[model samples]
Every structure is written in structure tokens, then in C-alpha cells.
Target chain A: MIENAFYSQEKHGPYKLFSLGNFELEEGGIIPDCKLAYATHGKLNEKKDNVIIVPTWFSGTSKDYESYIGKGRALDPDEYFIIVINQIGNGLSSSPHNSLPPVSMQSFPKVRIGDDVRAQHRLVTELFGVQEVALVVGGSMGAQQTYEWAVRYPEMVKRAAPIAGTAKNTIHDFLFTQTLIDAITSDPGWNLGEYRSNAEVADGLKRHADIWAVMGFCPEFFNQEKWGLFGVESAEELVEGFLEPFFQMMDPNALLAMAWKWQRGDVSRLADGNLAEALGRIQAKVFVMPIDTDMFFPPTDCEREQQMIPNSELKVIHSLAGHFGLFGGEGPSYHGQIDEHLKALLAVPVSESIVEQ
Target chain B: MIENAFYSQEKHGPYKLFSLGNFELEEGGIIPDCKLAYATHGKLNEKKDNVIIVPTWFSGTSKDYESYIGKGRALDPDEYFIIVINQIGNGLSSSPHNSLPPVSMQSFPKVRIGDDVRAQHRLVTELFGVQEVALVVGGSMGAQQTYEWAVRYPEMVKRAAPIAGTAKNTIHDFLFTQTLIDAITSDPGWNLGEYRSNAEVADGLKRHADIWAVMGFCPEFFNQEKWGLFGVESAEELVEGFLEPFFQMMDPNALLAMAWKWQRGDVSRLADGNLAEALGRIQAKVFVMPIDTDMFFPPTDCEREQQMIPNSELKVIHSLAGHFGLFGGEGPSYHGQIDEHLKALLAVPVSESIVEQ
Candidate 1:
């Protein structure tokens, strides 16, 4: 079988793998040898107080962060040491695509958002000897990790900006994620995660892209013929150019693994299913940013969750791009709002002494 | 090949077939012979003025309307001669599953919402010699036909109730329908719609069910564990009992055909791409009813279209069951509201004089 270039670290990034030796998953599974692929930019200050961790979203790699992390951007690598940690099951990391026999695609253990955070924590503290995270910010599944970081390690994370994600995966979201996973798995080519090549599951990936086209953007995005902005004339062209090619590059099992984690994202799992209690544990200065027209994570949902987080502020980003607004691919319109907010968030003075909430 | 019981009209209904020797589609396709399966309740009065026409929804048959039609119900069979016409491509009717070669399975031509209405118009006028329809009522895709019938043959339809559907398919609805169709076609067992048995595409059907579980109902319906009322212990059971089995019985290509019609449901095609002009042509006493919590057809979307129909009333059904609230299956709690509104709609006197709007 031809090796898939989509999973290769050399093509997508300047990622370095940190082996965890043996890692136990939160959901009672263990990987004999687990490794996390990550990329670092700029320089770590002498005091080690300039660290800002950005976890990768589903199907995204560390390389994809370049647009969001440059000079004068929200995550300016010139000023802060920006570490982009690729989430597990994203192919680059120790995932279904690259894991060994015991934890390979067919037997890969179920992972949680907490597991990714735990792995990132080990990489930050062990490899770089970082005592605290100056800020943790990301969008979509990255936003999921940002919330996990704030709730799991309150003392270590000083500030967090979770955009287009939630503290808990809503029932609506869980169902959507399940359908996405099922779409890939139902493909005969999947063969229960034992496909010989990515070509086998091409149809599944295409279908997965179709689902994203529907759910990923605001209705006006299509009704207003916004695909023209992306150099596409029709809905069919939008799917062909944007959605299909994007998802088709990734491994189906890897996408399924990440979707499973996304479906089970709930900080409250640590607090015995008490969401309010889980949210109350956060000590980070929270900026809960949600896109206004996002069908997946609506402002109403984000605002409700924000009200539960005692020290959190809700900032609604208005854009027709919906969940993709955070990526700023539609235009520079949303990037300006995001950069302004992050600058303000970084300006807030951190407390000298860390205390448990 | 084993005969599929699901496609047999004898086992599931009291349906009678009406053959349209040769039928042409709006989208430049022709079926050598077209047949529509339909069921009728009550008796045609001496004057034939007590006629109420009901069309089947997507994947639905005439038998499925039993719950919504009965004595003293919204569609009381005792008071009117109700003709429940199965939409073309719903298996029992002229569908991808039941049609002969040239228009069967792999070769079935694309159908539109207008085509189904056109077929129904022939059955109503030519077969029954019906001069006027006292009322035309239906939900979901049935509602789509209700709108088409009113707009296409304004003089024949005196009253119309289109519930949980819109005059023109919204961009969001079109996208959702596309995802659903893709889900089935992506299945390897589908073999481009030539699958040997229903078992071949079971996974695709299950995934389709999962999508419906998310978009078909309000989030509160699942969040509050309202499925418990149906005697299901968990969400898994709800999927097993309600969603999975409900869709598993239908043919994939048939569902795809209906979904294509649903995605392209635009009466504006008749008015040269003006939705308001198409809706403005309705001479019926229109009742535009939409469920409050329906994610697919939200009250906001329904209300906007309702405004376009110059002489129409918007009655929002407040129920957490969402789109399924129209089915009256949420323990009959929502049935009372639907009954009340439908009764009110029925009570409105039909004007004797018909004037072009």
C-alpha cells in the first residue's frame, strides 16, 4: 500500500515528537508508547513566562497555525513562544494512522479531551520546563483543548480564549459528531478501520465533506453565494474545491478518532457530571468567544456556558462565515476582531500568587 | 433475488395504483410509464365538495398517515373524502426500488417537488373527477406538495395547511438534504444504487438515522431525556427503536429521489424565480404552521416564508419534539396544540368567488 502523504510530519510541519513512554487514557485504555507531535515558534524568554500553547483542531496540523500566529497577529510568535501541539488522532501525533499493534487503527483506545491536555502538559513541563502557560487559545477542537487546559490545570493556565467550542459537548453536537463518524465507518472501504489505502475510503471522506459544508457555515453564507469569495461559482464547486479536498487528505480512522474525542468533550466528567462545578474550578481569565451565526456553537450556548464560569467574559464574533470565521479564511474582517481581543486579554496583569479556586 | 417485503404495497397498505401511461419530468427526463400508489378514506359526497387531499412525506407511505388521520382528528376521514397520495419515489409509488428498467435503481431519473404535485393533480382531476379540493393538508415533504398544489392549481385548492415545510427550500435545508443523500450514496454496499439486499446499506441507514436524530428534533428533546417517555432507557435505545428501524425499512435510492425533490422544492420555478410571486399566486386559505423547536425548519424561517403568502396565517407549534412534533408521536402532548390550530383552520369558511390574486 502507498504511504499517505497527509499523515507525514515532514510535508505538513516542522514538528518534533515527544515520547511519553507509556500513557494511560482517561477512558480506561493504554498506549504502550505514546508520542505527541508539536511545533514551536519565536523564542522562549529567559523567565519562561512568554509561553502560549495552541492545540490543533480536528484534521488540522501545527503548520496550519502559521496564518493565525505571525507578527502583529493574535498569536504573534515574535513576542511570545507559540507552541502548536497537534492533537492525538490527527495522524501527525501518535494516532490510529501511525500507532503500533496494541494501539493501532483497529485497536486504538478511545481518547478524551482530558487525555490531549494531559499529554500537552507533560510536553510543556518535561521538555521545556515551563512552569505556567501565559495564555492558551485556539478555535473549534483547539478551543475544546483550551477549555480543558483552563479547567484541568487552573494554576498553570493564566488566560484562555476558547473560540467556537464549548465547556461541554452539547447533545446536539454529540449527535452531529456521531453522524460524521458513522458516515466514514459506514463506507465499505472502511472495513472497520483496516483499509489498505486512503483511496479505498474516498467516498466516505467526500460524504464527510458534504456534512461539513452544511453544518460548518451560516445559511447566509451559501444563500448570499459567498462561495464566490473563495473563487468558486456554485455550491458544487464549493464542495469540490474547499470541503472535499480538505477532508480527503486525512485518514478516515484518524478523523473518526478525533470525532470520538470531540463528541465526548466535557470538563464536567471530572466533577462527576456536574458542569457548573467543573466550570467553577477554572482560575484562568476566560474570554469565551463564539461566532454569532455558528450553527454548531451558537452565541446563546456560548453565553450560557460563560455565565457559569465565574471569571469569564462572553465576546460574540459576528460573521456570516459561521464556525469557519475563527480561521479567518473568508477574509481579514474577523481576524481584526480576534487580534484586538487577544491583545486586550494579554494586557491583563496576572496574579503573583496562584490559589486553588 | 429475494423479494423485499418493505417494497410490497400489499403488506403495508390498502393502496391502489394509478398509472400515467407516460410521464415527463420538469428536469428534462421521461419515465416510460408512471404510477402513483394512493389510499383513500371516507366516501366522496354527492357534490364531491368534501374532498381533502393529503400527500405522503419523504420516505412515508399512505399507511403511515393513519396516526394523523382519523375520526375527530385534524384530518378527519369521517367529515371528508381524504385522498392520501404517496409521493413519487417512496417505494410503493413509482420509485427507484419499484420502477422497471430504464427508470429503476441505477437508472432512475431525477424527480422534483413539482413533478409529484403534477402527478397528484392528474390523479385528483382525471381519476376522481374532482372539481375542487376543500382542503389540502400535510407535514414535511407532504407540506412541500401542499404548497405546490396551492400555487400550481390555485383554482382547485380552496384551503391549504403546509406544516413543517416552506414554499421554497432554504439554503440550510438544501444543504441538510444534500448531506442526507450523500450519506447513503457513500455506502460501498450501495454500489451506485444497485445493492442486493437492505442489509448491504444498513450502516448508511443507521448513519442517516443519526443525522435525523440531531436535525429532526429540538436539543431539549434529548437533553431532557424525553425519549424516556417512549419507554426507551437511553439515547442508544431511542436510536434502536425509533430512528434506526424507522428508516431501515425504506430503499436508499427511493429516499435519495425524494430528498432530491425536497432539496429542489421551489415553487418560484413556476413564477420565473420569484418566490413571492409564486407564493402570491395561492388562492387558498393558507395556514403556514411550523414547529417552534424544529432545527431544520425553524419558526423564524417558516414565518419569513409565511409573510410572502399574502393571505396566510402563521401558527407556530410550540413543542420540544421539534420537526417530529408534526407526527404527534411525543406522547400526544403536542397533538392537542396541532388539533386546536387545525380545527380553527378548518372552521374558516371557503369563499364562493375565486379571483386571481
Candidate 2:
């Protein structure tokens, strides 16, 4: 007899979903109550001074960074309090997919990194009574959020580790994301972003898969192995393999909303009119690690940021894994280099705390 | 008064349309008796040795390049014969927009650079009785066609100049095109790629405009002189300004079809299945010039070709105009460099004549 495996231990996370009360969404739309999904893996010590902020990547949930959080890893839960907050459109949290009708694009709230960090800040301060974070760690879009936390709440974050991220998006990145989003919404079957099943939007998904496969690997990888990633066959098949499980698991509306958020992403917009000044206000020691093979967010873009933030260091990862190599690989794949840097970052003493001005 | 206002200059062009009895287009669809609209400037010399081929840019018509011809310019009609072939789905050419019913995504024939060059070859040999060309020059997608001409019919093309082009598309290019196509076909009003003028489908067009605006200019251009290419104050306004004219200019079906063709473009797919052999077979002298700020076709990609082709030269255009700078304003643009190159190219003895076989 098959046991009810649906309620497995693996599915249970460190934190549960919290209702933040009635909240106005966007475009003159409203949700009677908004729920924020989050997971915390480390214990908060007496002073609550060892917390670290970890935001979700685009299409990634709080579970995505789990590999880096367990025993002996750089962000080992045994040593620090790690808070992983789910961004608005991540399905488990507030999203268009689970929400009721009037579910048009306009109805979806306009969320930036600042908005995400702000909402997450409320959760940390009100519920956990967390005062300051030791570091904010993330990769890709998550890294963008980490940067946002430092800028938006200078007093709350003591250090930031933004990996494979950008200061201001290059035209190429904007074009890439815009295209991916367009592919999904353009399907006649999409019915104006209303189609939620894989059946209706299969073509769009296939096209989306094709684009993703290319961005997730390096040119050298393509030259050597064609389209195979680890051991996949074709670019289409790779995306298919990934999306088959992912699309079914995800809320399509949440995916759509997150895509909309990604397209509008620009931390430079929040520079209080001056980007350099905003970056300067980042009291946290910033560590910008851009992956060399990451076509989505090139290392040069990170190098550009290294120059802007005064107490920042750039750690370039050399791997053919592209954007995802930051998390999904072995110790040698990225850890050795990252560990070396983290050890150095950990050694640096936290200077001048944010005195309540 | 109207007659005097519009000088009816002698229609000196043999700008005839080629009628295909029963040919398929590039969108997995067929067009019975398809006709390709084209314009020819300059006179075919007695021996037809002064022929120059100019393929149209993406979203551009044969008419857009008309100004570059005539008495002056590098492609002076007074000096050589110039052929401007309208790519399939440019409205005037046989496209889903104007075709009979069943105008959907599956209606277009899958076409690559080989198909385009092959058709142009027939037009040149059978229609114009042109045995050889002095030069084939094109920018962007047009450049891809020019490269195909050199690879497919090495003996026919004496010289080739591909500006802001790549030997093979990078994954980045693939993803961008994939996304653009997705945006066009995803709208519910798209009616499975059948929607012609539906308002819902118009949103896809807006998305396309948003993406297109990002690539059309450099960040410096947007930062320094925000003249608003699409006219609105901000990025959203800019997207609005762009889509307003863009969508109205062509049928959505045609755009989708065109994009499909572009996505399938691969010059290596031509010849006897060996890409290296195809590159080696190009007996024509080649000049591959990539613009420094060209976000779509990066310079490093073009440099890849420099290592492959034997009798080839790589020229880098340092311009802030991005892709368009390959065909832009005054002295520093690609036009100036192209003019100098053309003068040099004109002086080089035809490749066939260089070493009499």
C-alpha cells in the first residue's frame, strides 16, 4: 500500500507563511489580506546579531538556496541566523496565480527590490524582532535584492555578498528578459496572460526553454558539448526536462508577475536621484562576485560596481555553468574560491554600528 | 500643383517582383506563387561586373535603403548595379499578413540564410543574367544574407562585406530573438498567431517595442541625450512611443513570420553539412566589420570569424550608435569607414581573376 507521501519532511521548511493583513496590490487592485512566505534556517542568538538576509532569485523559491545553508557551508545555519524571504510573485507568497479575479497585468502590484526588501524588513522586525543582518547573500536576481537591502536599509545590513549580479542592467540583459517574458505572453493560447496550464502555453514554454538553455551555459561549454548541460542532449530537451517539473510545480500567474518584476528591475532608480550616493550609503561591506561564464550578468558589470562602492571587493567565479553555477555545483566548482573569500570576509571586524541617528 | 510637387523622376529601377509559382515561406507555412518585392538602383554594366548586392535590415523595407543609393554615397547607382531584396514578411513581400486564410504560426515555411541567398542567386543568374558580383554588402540580418552568398555560391560572389554580423549566432542572440517572437505570439487575441489587429495582441507589440528600444541605443546615448527615440518621458513612455508606430506599421502575423525566419537563420546549415568546409569554400574576399557598441552582435563574436576565413579582414567600428552606427551619421559612423573600405575593395582585383584557375 502506498503511504501518503505528500506530507513529507522534505516539504516542511524552517519557517511558515505569515499573513501580513489586508494589502492593496497595484494598479488600483487590492487583496483583503496578503501572505508573505519565508524560511529561516539558523538560530538567533541572545543579541540577535548574527542574522543574514537571503532573497529569492527570479523563478526561485526559498528552497533554492537550501544547499548553501546546511552544515559546514559558507552560510552554515549552525553559526548564523539565515532568513530567506520569498519575493511577492513566488506563488507560496502573495501572487496573481492564487489570487482571485480582476487578475489582469495591471492588477499585479509593481514590485521592485526596494519593495521586496521593505516587506521583508517588516517581517524581520515585527515577527522575528531581528535588528541587523551580518550579511545578505544571493545570486542573480536574488543578488540584486541583496544589493537593494544594503541600499534601502543601510542600518539593517552589516555586510552584503551579491553574487552574479549587476548594478544597472545592460541593454543585453533587458533585451534577454523582455524576450523571455514576451515568449510566454505572446502565445495566442496565453489568452492575454490568463492561461495557467502547460497545455495552453506549451509553445511559449518551449520557446522560453530554448532561450534559457542558451543563457545558462558558457560559449566554451556550447563549443565543447553543444547544448548538453551536465548530461542533457539538446537545448530544447534541456529546457523541457527542467520546465516539465518546474512549470507543473509553479503557479503560472506568479511566474508572470515575477517576470514583470524582473523586466522593471533597476536598483539605480532608487539612488535617491544619485546612484553613487546611494551606493556610498551602503554601510555594509559589499562583496560583488560575478561569474565569468555568466552571460546573463557578465563579470564586467560587477567590476563596474566594484568601483562605485568604496568598501567592496569583486570575486570572479570561473565556471562554464553560467548563472546557476553560483549554487548548484560542488565545492571545487565554486566553493574553494568562494570559501577563501568568505573566510577573509568573516575575519573582517564589523566596524561602527548603525547608531540610531 | 501635385504633379510639380512630386517630381516623377524617371522610374530608372528594374524594381520588379519575382513571382514564385508554388514556394513555401519560412514560418512552417506555404505561399502558393509567392512574389518577392525588390528594387534595383544603378545600371548593370555591359558585362554585369559592377553589381553590388544590398540586403535589407531587420524590420526594414527595400525602400528604407533607397536613400543610400543614387548619384553619391558608397553604393552610387551611377557607378554600379545594386539589388535590394525585400526579405520575406516585410509586408510587400509574400507574408502571412497579406496571404489568404490560415495565416497563423504554422503557416510560414522555415527559411534560413541559405534559402534567402538561394532565392537571390536565382534572381541574379536567371532574372538579371549576372554571372558575378563586385561586392555584396549588408548590415545586421542583411549581413547574414551577404555571408550566405559568399558561402553558398563562392564562385558567384567576388567579394563580401558583412557589417555588424556574426559567423554563427551566439546563445545570447538566439535567446533575444526567441523572446521577441514569444511576445508576438503569446496574446490570447493572437488567436494562435492568427490575430491581425486585436487590441490584446497589441500588448505583445508593446512588449516588443520595450525590448527593441533597449538594443537600438547605447546606455550612454540614453544617459547623455534623452531625446526619446519613442518620445515618452520615461522607459514606459518610450516603450509606448515605440509600439504606437511599430505595430500599426505592419501586421502582427508578418512580424511573427519574420521573427521565425530570423530565429531559424544559420549559415552553417548551408553547403555539404560541414561548417568549416563552408567557411573554407568562400573564395570571395571577405570584410567582417563589427561595431564596438553593438549590443546585439558583439565584436568578439565577429572576431571568431576572423580566425576561420582565410582571405578575410576584420575591421572594428568604434561608434556609440550601437547597431545603427554601422549605417549612421557623419564622419565617425560606419558609413565613413565603409566608404574607405569600398574604395579599397573596388581597387582589389576580383578574386576569380587573382589566380586564374
Candidate 3:
């Protein structure tokens, strides 16, 4: 299969790129000449103490997070050095759709959330020569990586806000992820991920979009006719106009690679499957923010994990858009809640948190 | 496409059959040599005042209701004559897999809930010579039929209890059902429902089962590890051992047929999309029962419909199993609630209900 420029910089606009030559994965595979696609805002201070890191979510690029990174926003470019990095297998980065042979396409390296954190680690510590991070925050799959960062380098991460995602993925979520993977792989056009074009797997990709239409947003969102806010008058329009085109344009194999890792996201692996022990190791002041209406990462699941971490609070984000509220579908109020919480998390004195730890 | 013996009476045990040669459909098509597969318990009293009707849900047969029929249960085979009828396209009935060439497989006529109600109407009136039915109760698609029966023949149905369903299929539910349909159709082996063997569409069926696993049960069921109660130790086993085997045993075309009709279940079509006006016509003592945790047909949706029925009462059934509570997955308390509600609905004097109406 030839690499499709479906998610390339030329198509989705330019972003900064870094090379991680033949990077080894936590799941025991290699991404030959692995590349990281990222975008930045603001500038690092002379002390490099005002640095912040945010990551991309499932099926998201560095560009999707632009909504939260404007002037006077929570991720204000004027206040902090903000870096929005893409996750491996998220098309813009080294992925199934764009990697070279021997370690490409269906053979692309399996990457766990930890692998993503470690790659970001090299970019932050080695490339930027930064020894401390002011904060690490993200939503969904991005949240999973944020938790990994806090747990993996507790001394370095002063504060963390993992939004709408669980550190230890639930069996329910695992099975849910399986259905998304099955949707694409089951198609004949998949051809073991050897298809010439995403159009070849159009039906399967559309099927994937259909699943997202149901589970990506909560029932009440549809019940309240909130898709009207998304510029769709009906459910059919929401699926075809908004959901279908976004997913159909992406490569199916890249999605499978990310899905496999998302299903296996569990920081508790650090403590031999003991969630409390792994979370107990975190020294950073953390905010476990989950969307109240999110069926994928319900607030209850997030609260349970928050209780296990010391100096952490469960911050519930109410949004009719459920999981997709990260994309502004939750209305203007959704972003208001996000900005308020991030501002508070940033305001907490770091020294006080260190003393408590 | 040849009819597999998968859902044949010879394979799933015998049921009485009724022929409606060249049966007409509500959706403007004909089901040639239409057959209704059903099972009856107890005898029809001389006055025919002791009859009870129960229709099957999607992917269910007459046999699946056996658990609720017994000497002293709500169905009470020893007292009330109970007839369980299978919906058209449900394997045992004349379906895409079983019908002859003129209108079989992909060409199977579209059937609305009203059509199933009409066909069952013939079996009760023409075959059994019964005019006044005592009670009609069902769950899910069966519940849709129950609502249709009450609306179509108001005087004939003395009491109606529609469990875990709504009179009008919500746009949320319509889109959700689309995913199930997409799962089967996207599979290349489906070949537009022309596959010779059900095994040819194994991946598609499994995908269907995966969707059911996520939506069929409430999130609490999975969060609390209730699969252990089902004799499965993990979610993987729950999907593979329980959900997969049940769906894999059925034909794809029949499932598509039922799913299509399910998506279009709107009783309001009788009064130009005015739900209140259509449900206001119900003359039966109605009991609209919805499971509190049910994501598909939540109590909120059912209560909205029940309010429109002048003589109806909203009965909430609490179950962790959600929609699957109909299949005993909600545990003993689930059936206990069903029995209690049905008994109360039946005990209400028919003349008093008529006077109230």
C-alpha cells in the first residue's frame, strides 16, 4: 500500500516535525525513522519554568485542539509555552497509512500510551532541555497519556488534568473499542490493510462513523436535539455531514493501530495490575475531569480513579455532547467549564502541592 | 439464497404455523406464502376472556419467552391462555432465508410493526375465531407490536403493557439501529444478503453481536462486573461465549429485515406524526413499563408516551440489565417487577377502565 497524503501536512496544514530514528515501542515493535507531528504556541521563558504540554486524542490531530488555544483562552498562547503533540498512529505522526515498508501499514508498530509519553518525554527534556513541566493536560486518549506522564515522571510534572478519559481502561470500553476495530477490518476492501485507497474501504469507514454517531455522543444530546448546535438539523445529517467525512477521509489501518493501544491503556501496568498502587505513586496535583454525559468515560469511572490518587479532585464537566464536547459540540457553555477548571488547576501554587506530597 | 435450518422449527423445536397466502404489507409490498410461527399454552376459555398475547423481540423467537410462562407466573399458563407469536423475518417465520424466489432474501418485503400486528390479528380472528382479546403485553420490538395492537384495535385489547419500548422510535434509536444494519451490510461476505450459509457472514454477525454487547445492557452492568453472574469471568467471554453464539446462529437477511422495521416503529404515523393525538385513541387500560437504566428506551422516553395515553400509568422497572432485563439478565427482581406490574394491570376491572375511557 502506498502512503496516502490524506493526513499529511500539505493536506491538513503545516505542523512542526521531529524524527525519532527507528524508535522502539513499549509493546515491542519498531516504528522505523519514527516521526512526531506537533504544533506550538507562546514561547518558553528564560527559566523554561512556564512550559505546558497537551496531546491529541483519538482520531485527532494537533489542529483539532486549536479551539482551546487562542488569545485569552485556557491554553492562552501569551501566558505559557504550549505544545500540542500528535500521538503515534494518529495519521500526522508515524502511522499505518504513512510509514515505510518493513514497519509500515498493517505492520506499523503497536504503540501503548506509555510509548507516546516517552516520545513526548524526549521532545520535552532532550530537545527543549526542559527539566520541569508546569502542567500536562489532555482529553480522551490524550488524557490517558497525561496520566502516564504524571505517573512516569511525577517529579517533573507539577500538575495534571486528564480529561474525559480513564487511566485504567474499563472492560466495557475495551469491548467498545473492539467494535470500532471490527468495523474496518471486517470489510473486504480492507484487504489486510493493503487497500490502494480509503475509498476502497468506504463502506467500512462509514460503518465506523455510524458507530461513533451512536456512542460518541450521549443519548440526551440527541434527545434534546443538540445536533442542531453542530449545524445538523437531523441525525442523518449529523452522521453523513459531520461524522462520515471526518472519519472516511482518514486511513482505516491507522485507526486500528490506535484503537489497539486505546483498548490496552492502563497505567496500573506499572504496579503489576494494581491501580491504587500505581495512582498512589503520583506526586503531581491532579484534576480528573470527566464529561458527565460521556458514555465512553463516564464521571463515575473517573471519580473512582480520582479517589485512588492523593491530592487529586474529581472535576466533572457537564456537556450534552458527551465525549465529543472536546470538539465544541457541547455548546459555548462546555468550553466555559473547561476554561474555568484549567485556570484553577494552573493557579494552584506548585510549592503547596510539593509540600503536601 | 437457501434457507438454513438454523432457525427452522426442526432445529429450534416445533411451533404452530398459520398461512396467510399472498399477505399484504403496511409498507406497500407482499410477502408471498406468509407464515406465522407461534406457540400457545393453556386453553381458550369458552368466553375467550382469558387470552393473553405476547410477541417476540428482535433476534428472539417464541421459545425465548418460555422463561416467563408457567403455572403461577404473570403469564400463568394454568389460568390465562398465552400465545407467543414470532415476528416476520424471524427465522422460523416466512423470512428472507426461508421464502421462495419471487420475494425472498434481499427482496423480502418491508414490514412495519403495524403489519405484524395485522398478521397476528388475522391469526386471532380468522384462525381462532376470537374477537375480544383479554390482554396484550410484550417487550422491545414485541412492545412496539403491543402498542400497535392497542392503537389498531382499541376495543379488542382490554389491557396493554409495553415494556422497555416507546410508541415512537426516537431519532437516537433510529441512528443506533443503523449501526447494527451497517455491521452486516458492510461485510463483503454478506453479498447483499445472498450468502448461502450464515457462516459466510460470521464477521458481520460478530460485529452485530459486539454492538449489542455495548448497547443491550446498562453501563452499570459492566461497571459492576455483573457478567460474573452470567457465568462468564470476563467481558471477552461474555461477548464471544454469550452474545456471539446467539447472533451467529441466525441469518443476516432476517436480522436486517427486523432492524429496518424496528427503526421505523412510530405509532404517530396514524395521525400525521402527532404522537399525543395517536396515543390518545387508546381505549385499553395501558401500563407503559420502562426499565430505569435502559439506554435504548429510557423511562423518560416511555413516560412521555404514557402521558399521552389517557388511561395509562407509567410503571418503572428497575434493572441493572437495562433492555436485556427482558431475558432475565436483570436477575430475579427483574421478573418479579414484571409479574407485579402485569398483575396490577390485569386486576383492574375491565368495565371500570371502559367507563374511565
Per-prediction RMSD in angstroms? 3.4, 5.7, 2.4
lDDT of 2 at A18: 69
Q: Which residue pairs clash within candidate 3? A: none
Q: Write the per-residue lDDT of candidate 1 for residues B1-357, one digit (tens) a residue.
A: 224688775666888999987899988888877999999999999898889899988887888777777788877878889999999888888888777887878789998989999999999889999989998988899999999999999988988999898888887788899888877776678888899876788877877877888788766676667776556778878887878987887788888889989998889999999989999888889989888877777777778788988779999888877787766666467777767877888888888747545
Per-residue lDDT over A9-117 for candidate 3, one digit per residue giving the tens place of the 0 to 100 score: 7775558888888799876878878888888899999989888899889999888887787788778889999989999988888888777788767788788999999
- The true-structure Cα RMSD of candidate 2 reads 5.7
lDDT of each: 0.84, 0.68, 0.86
**Greater-TM-score candidate between 1 and 2:** 1
Q: What is the C-alpha interface RMSD of model 3?
A: 1.3
Estimate candidate 2's alpha-carbon lDDT, on a 0 to 1 scale. Answer: 0.68
lDDT of 1 at A231: 70
Whole-model alpha-carbon lDDT for candidate 1:
0.84
Q: Comparing 1 and 2 by lDDT, which wins?
A: 1
**lDDT, residue A7, candidate 2:** 18
Model 2 docking category = incorrect
DockQ of 3: 0.66
